[model samples]
Target: MEPVLLAAVVLFAGAYAFINGFHDVSNSVATSVRTRALTPTVAVVLASVFNLTGALLSTALALVLADRFIQLPAGTPGLGILIAGLLAACGWGLWTWWRRMPSSSTHALVGGIVGSGAASTLVGGPNIAESYQVLLQQIVLPLLLSPVIAFVLAYLLVFPTTWLMRYSSPRRGDAGNRIAQSVFTSAFSLGHGMQDGQRTMAVIVLALVAAGFSGTTGIPLWVQIFSGVALAAGSLFGGWRISRTLGSRLVRIDPLRGMSATAVSSSMLFLGAVWLQIPLSSTQTMTSAIVGAGANQRFSTVRFIPLREILVTWLVTAPVTALLGGILFLAISPLL
Candidate 1:
């Protein structure tokens, strides 16, 4: 039973990574695609490559997730919760993607785990207080503040970036901004991979520990490769509908603004993943950055309705997914 449950957990984790890839790829490439900095194919390829590279480079955030956020009991019960949580996260991801909403996959996963963890506590799992403290300090705070910071910084960044190109003609400015946007797109893709890939890695590690495959909650190379490859494949597939939401519908973004948004987002990603060792929603940060850059140009240029809708989605994602995950755990645990 443990072996079978472990296999299922690993498989579901990979699938979740794949869903996350296409689901969140828009964050890295949307602005560049919108501004014509890169063709869709080129942008996707760039994202895939860098995302894979980023996934390979970091385990710090993964460690934090596996060790700090929530601990699962060994054997069947733990594996069952993880499987249900992944399913709930995946379901929300697919729904949001279908609706072309730029929601936070990070929040969804966290919510799922939280719900599952809470459920587990009802059945003799570890105390939820410590995990909740970690969640608030590490996950919730960073996820919430990063977007607001991204918005403000991107808004301010437009001043410098815009000034630098003020002397250039439209054609020349677009060309320069395209080149810069591509550079930042690569950086953002790398950071996105590192941050999001770690989420998958942490899940796989938890599964491994619960299965007794490993006594420790460390991310192994095979786990990294597995998570990275699945995520990269998803990125290669791309999410055209959500891409359109972030790239075009959110704002009529110019190349310069696109570059600024990506820059701001990538910086925040690095800060969260590398320095803070926290999980952030690249979706929120990038989307907020895009809005900030757009908002700086003219209030009317930034569409409020979609922004409002996206915000509502963000606000509700955790709690809704938590409910879904908890319900899923209850429904599926018996069968397992």
Candidate 2:
């Protein structure tokens, strides 16, 4: 690949990362903002800043995931595949955003990559492993289990805490819990930065490596800083639509419930980033936590309609994006 082409690919990847950041920022701060724990502007600013700080805190996991997923065998993938994958991911993301549905950008990107890779390999012929263990163990497992774990954890954690505090004065408890909620919200923002922000960095790094601008697993400092800043800026802008859905429509979040959900999400996210080394979606985990917390309050608190929409979005994100990716790859293959 020529230097100019490589640079162009890197730039495209950066833009994709920025989109990811802006699109997903609401996942971290929506609850806090909706509950009046933070004003929208303040929530966005704080979340964005912490997110940037968190990105600087972790690089190893992102690098590993990037190497595993993005850098295909030399000559196995071409520019067409890359463009298709990105466009498909972006397109699916925008579709979900338009409907105010909470979908997984991570899944969309993964689907795009898989679809494009499969298509490119079928056409160009590469001996890449179709059934890599990392894909199953790291990507699939986390995606399948993280939400369940978050839901159960939040459900279990919230009720007991609330029960214990039942005898306390409501006003005092609310005030104290509000302060605690703020702390937990900040922690959630930090964890969100650590986990979710790294995903964009990983994607950009993968693009650079794919275009031969960077060696495998070696993400540039500028790339990291740029991705971090872009994501933070996006968070600062915030996504109020999703925030309303997650924070209010899902359940009425008292400070205790909010704190419980945030804690569970942060814990799951950090474990995935540091131990499991998987790039799980913060939005999914948090949503599950919210559901769990709501169920703990009352089974009826979990709204089935909105949840069904979310599930449908999740189910469709991968396949639809994959199909789009495959089609786009084919269409652009002639030019590339």
Candidate 3:
């Protein structure tokens, strides 16, 4: 019974990673595809390859998630919390993806954990305060600030990029811009793997800990490969609906601005994952960068209705997932 339940937890974690890829990886390539820098197929392939590379390269952020997030109890009850949290995150990812909305998988996962942690208290689980503290200090604060910074940095970056290209012929500039977009989108996908890959890895590690197979948060190589492959597979599948929203509905993006957005977002993702050991939303950073770069051309070019809808969803994602996680945990605890 215990082994079967552990397998179920692993299965759900894989599902979250796949849903994450379907929903979030598209952000890395949306601008590149829209700008004709890469065809849809090429972009998705590049993203999948680099995302796997990035996932395999590091476990720094994954360590933070395992050690600092929440304390998972030993046995089936702990597995139940993880199952509920994963389901909540997966459900939110699918819902937002279906709506063609680009939402944060990172936040959804954190909210799910926080929600499940709170619910676990009823079953003599660890205090929820620790999870709450980390959520605010680590996840929520960064979530609020990173998007604004991505927007401003991208907005400023467009000035210099445009200025540098001003002297070049349109044909020459377009060619250079395409190359730049491709390179930056690859880098962004690599960074996305680093940021989001750790998320699923952390959840898997937590599951292992709960099952009493491991005494520490050390990530096994097999676990890393499994998480990487799941995410990469999802990336291969891609999310064209949300990609269309990001590529066309939010702003009219040109090759130069698209390159600038990718550059800014990729740099931010690297900074957050490698240096800060923090998780960031590739979707949030990329979307904000697109808007930022587009606003530089003309604010009117930024569509408010769609942007408003995205913002509302972003604002509600954590809270709504938290509630959903709690409900799911409560509902499933008895069976587990």
Clashes of each: 0, 0, 0
Tens digits of lDDT, candidate 1, 1-336: 888888888998999999999898888888888888999899999999999999999889999888887767777888988997898899999999999998998899889878877876666655355678878988899899988899999999999988888889999999998998999999999999999999999988988888888844467889999999999999999778898889878788998899899999998899989997888899999999999998888554988888899999999999999998888887876765
- Ten contiguous residues minimizing lDDT sum, candidate 1: 121-130
RMSD after CA superposition, every candidate? 1.5, 2.1, 1.4
Q: Which consecutive 10 residues in model 3 have the weakest lDDT in total?
A: 123-132
Using alpha carbons, what is the TM-score of model 1? 0.96
Query: What's model 2's lDDT at 166?
Result: 87
Off by over 4 Å in 3: 122-126
For 55-98, candidate 3 gives per-residue lDDT tens digits of: 99999999897887777777888788888889999999999999
- Candidate 1: Cα lDDT at 51: 94
Model 2 segments more than 4 A misplaced: 75-79, 125-128
**CA error at residue 201 for candidate 3, angstroms:** 0.8
Task: Return the TM-score for each candidate structure.
Answer: 0.96, 0.92, 0.97
**Per-model lDDT:** 0.88, 0.74, 0.88
Rank list by TM-score? 3, 1, 2
Q: Model 1, residue 295: displacement in angstroms?
A: 0.6
Model 3 global lDDT (CA atoms, 0 to 1): 0.88
User: Cα miss at 160, model 1 (Å)?
Assistant: 1.2
**Candidate 1 at residue 294, lDDT?**
88
